[model samples]
Target: MDKSHQTKAFRRERVRVGVVGVGGFGRSHLGAVESLASAGRAHLVAVADPFREQHVELDSRLSAQGVAWHSTLEEMLEKETLDAITIATPVPLHFGMTRRAVEKGVFVYLEKPPVPLLSQLDEMIAWDEDFRVAVGFQLIYSEPIRFLKQAILDGKLGTVRSIRGGAAAPRRQSYYNRASWAGRMSINGEPVFDGPMTNALAHVLQNILFLGGGDAWSFARPTSLRGELYRCYPVESFDTSCVRGVLDTGVEFAFAGSHAVRDESPHTLEVVGTRGTLRLTGGTFSSDIPGLELPQHAGSDVPMLASVSRFMDYVCGQPETDIIRLEDTRGFVETTNGTLVSSRGIFPLDARFVESYQVEGDPGLDVLGLGDLITQTITTGRLFSENSAPWANRTPTVTREEIQSAVLEEWIFGAEENPKNATACL
Candidate 1:
């Protein structure tokens, strides 16, 4: 009985689900689970979080739901016989937690970035033949985005020439202070790999990839990339990133993101093609081509809920549909990991370019010329290095082969590859 060929028996009754990690973004996963419960598509049988008692409000809310809780995941798993589980744990915990659930034959809805390292992702994908695992890239599940995808496939926008996407959101020091591992590249010598592009503004990056074609593996893979990573805040990882590359399909892709900028620009993904252009800004989609009519959808489900519901549908024997399986995100994992591997060293801005300010009575950091840089890269489809940003390095390049080599050596041969020294071999 090969594990790849093994399939979990479909549960005909209401699928019983559980969630792990109920803090930070976990609350969003819970809200989506509650939506599933309300719709009678699934039942949340239990929850697990070691720090639940510290947050009295969250504790009270879970109590109100009348579901059982445990201080640890082991306890919850022992008590509840769940058909599926949604993992909202930290990036460091994702691989192990999801692996345990999958080995136990439980279906999983895992949080984004799937896993921090490429080797970990490869292992998970190898065993996910039955498609029991769904990675939570919520925007891909949005009805509007899906419609736009089909429009592109239908040639409504013609051949995509280039893509510009990013988000300009600011985070105060308190955000990094929320957890011991917050904004850290590594915790206790293991990869947490949390940063602006990989975590916070990940949706923007993935949207650009998805818009290119198929899933992350087939459609969105970049042939080559140049990235400028900068840190305005005191963290091991960069908070501001600008990346530009050409996908294997030859479509140009550019992404700019920051947690240091002010609210000067709306988050957006604009696709430019030979025939027309399509833009998604602030959750609404519009295009320059006239007479583009989107079919009306049943009111939108909170992206997380929509994803959870679809996973539940699969568990209940619903015929296979176009859900975002874990393997579909290989291209995304490669891109993010490549960005981080290339962005290994912390290039802090000069004191003159950094501005200290009070954001909601909390300390914040902003770079003087970041906004213009963001806009310029998006407009011209150029990497920061090409645009001659003063802070950018001399021709910083990140290749897929380099990343794959480092990750393989680290994860397989047990060699400690220095992620920060990505240019050492070069």
Candidate 2:
């Protein structure tokens, strides 16, 4: 992940990529990939999704090239020799699918939250310094987020004192009601935590790390976590929750999220500091606000566009940017794991303060733009403690595996199952 390494090109002739799970994000990813392929930048070969209906749309849209469709994801993986797969499955399936993809040595453009559990993250990422693998953290692809990062760096906001974020949106029970896996924590077990944190506003923690200097392991810590399941959703108690914490750097941040808000427009971010403040009232998708510019790309995506023009460039390899490294992912995942800790009660004070950081000047003048690559810059080295937490009066330690293995409360995948006390890991 050095400048000299960035100088090396992971170029190819044509990126013969495949698409998996063409439901929501998959279709969008396919659009971008297809556009790249049609311009001869990348090749869109095939797609896989459980829903058969997904096939008709892509088949109609992608032309006769190599657009094979499959009802099951495994079948697609087994049948096709693909360079990569754009995975947009539900949150629960993210880990399993991404692991399988990397296991097959297929580079993966996996949709975000990386995986629900940190342990699941360890299972998927390839550690070899030789092969090429990528995680699809599309939030980084948004163009305007880049602008915010740069603006902060350029001192547009002067000194970033604290950041407060909110994502309040109502998801009809229908949305969670339609799919068996919608609000559940495990594809097999009950729902854990709430619907929003893992489901809707997952990026809250993500963008926080990006803004507060990425890599939560070294730079992040939870001072206090107070949130409610909101007593609304049937699946789990918390459909909404908020927490306040200090980055290891002591930068205070407040995060509030809810899947029950029911608003025509949802999502907003405002960072206050010494000079001025910036706010993204409606996220990248646009809202009633009207004038807010948006980002087209985000931190995690900058590298993909930088040197990658075709599938071959990917196959031959391009850069060794560990922008999406397992460790970097662990930074966020460990923090996610800490969320479970908060639920259990006593949150810990990490070993040291997070190193203070600032973005590199202009994230982009445009409010809506692909965020700067500064997010990746934060992980240029180890950002958090990888060893057990031996620095506390009560040095209790938690790993990603613990979270993945913990028994989730009993619940249904898409529906509720009657039960008093149940423990299962979906």
Candidate 3:
């Protein structure tokens, strides 16, 4: 064959990939892999999900695509010599599944909120000898966020003073009811800490920590954290939280997240510096610095696709330098664990301040004036307790070491009981 034809043939040698878990967000991972497969960048070899039989349409869809299905990851690993696997399983299952894949000498694209605890993360870091694991903190791959990080390193945001971020995406009772483990701190004695900061809106926190890092590839570890956690929903975990802390780099940071709000607000991240400030909201960036020009190209409209493509690139021999390695997320896990420990426990929000409403036939609980509280917290870079919310109480700050050594079950099961007489306002 000619030189050009030889190059084309070589390019067609795609990385073989399998996806574990094909429900909810897992389906998104499957779709991204399929997209890359269609482009000759990857081969979607197989997928594993014990609950696959329950999803008939999805089963037929996969069948039609000539993709193999396994009831478990063990079966998939035993049957296929896959190049890599993307794990989109529950928070508790991440570490175990990643460990299995690593043992089999396979690369892993672990879905985010990497794990529910720091100890689990440390274990993964210890055994991932070849740097074969990549966590799916997709926003780190976004053009705007990438541009922002480089700008910080280049002294565009001179002497970065602080970073603040907040996100308010309201969830209804149906949301928590979707799965047996949803919103639970533990399921069947396993840590699943499915709260806003740790689960649904985790990208915001991850981005904040990533931006706070002194270097481009590093994430700033939290030295100390203080948090106020409250739940309007009757779940084991909090529905609303406000965390304030200091990064190891001495850059102060604050974040607020909630699933108990009436209207959805854009996820916002603001970085303040001595010279100027940069603000990112709803995937767009703005700044007070005159003549600051960001990259004209927009990031992928589908972040998961971008993340999967990048992982495939790494699997197909690209440099690992840009990948979100497991170690890059220590700060994120530390912040998450510390926030929970600092809160002592998730408080039950007073029913007097909580209103019940139907959003498209789903029962949703909204904290009265929560939108205002979220705005105030983000604007002032303060925790909800410091902002004087009637239901808010400040918990003592906790150190990273304390968080690492803490037992999650002690806090998960030891929370104050909900008031039986309290009823949501209609």
Instruction: List runs of model 2 lying over 4 Å from the truth.
Output: 1-10, 60-63, 125-133, 189-194, 214-228, 283-316, 320-323, 345-426
lDDT string for model 2 (207-305, tens) is: 665666633212244443322222233443344444445565556666655543334234556666676567665544222223434454333354244
- For TM-score, candidate 1 versus 2, the one ahead is 1
Could you give the candidate ranking by TM-score, starting with the highest? 3, 1, 2
> Best to worst by lDDT, what's the order?
3, 1, 2
Number of clashing pairs per prediction, in order? 0, 59, 0
Cα-based RMSD of candidate 1:
4.9
Angstrom error at residue 379, model 1: 2.0
TM-score of each: 0.88, 0.68, 0.92
lDDT of 3 by residue, 91-200 (tens): 87887899999998888999998888888889898888677888999888777778788888988888999999998898988888898888887776678888888988
Q: Could you tell which candidate, 2 or 3, scores higher by TM-score?
A: 3
TM-score of 2: 0.68
State the RMSD for candidate 2.
Answer: 12.5
Q: What is the C-alpha RMSD of each candidate to the true structure, in Å?
A: 4.9, 12.5, 4.9
C-alpha lDDT values of all predictions:
0.74, 0.50, 0.83
Which pairs of residues clash in candidate 3, taking residues 3 or more apart in a chain or in different chains?
none
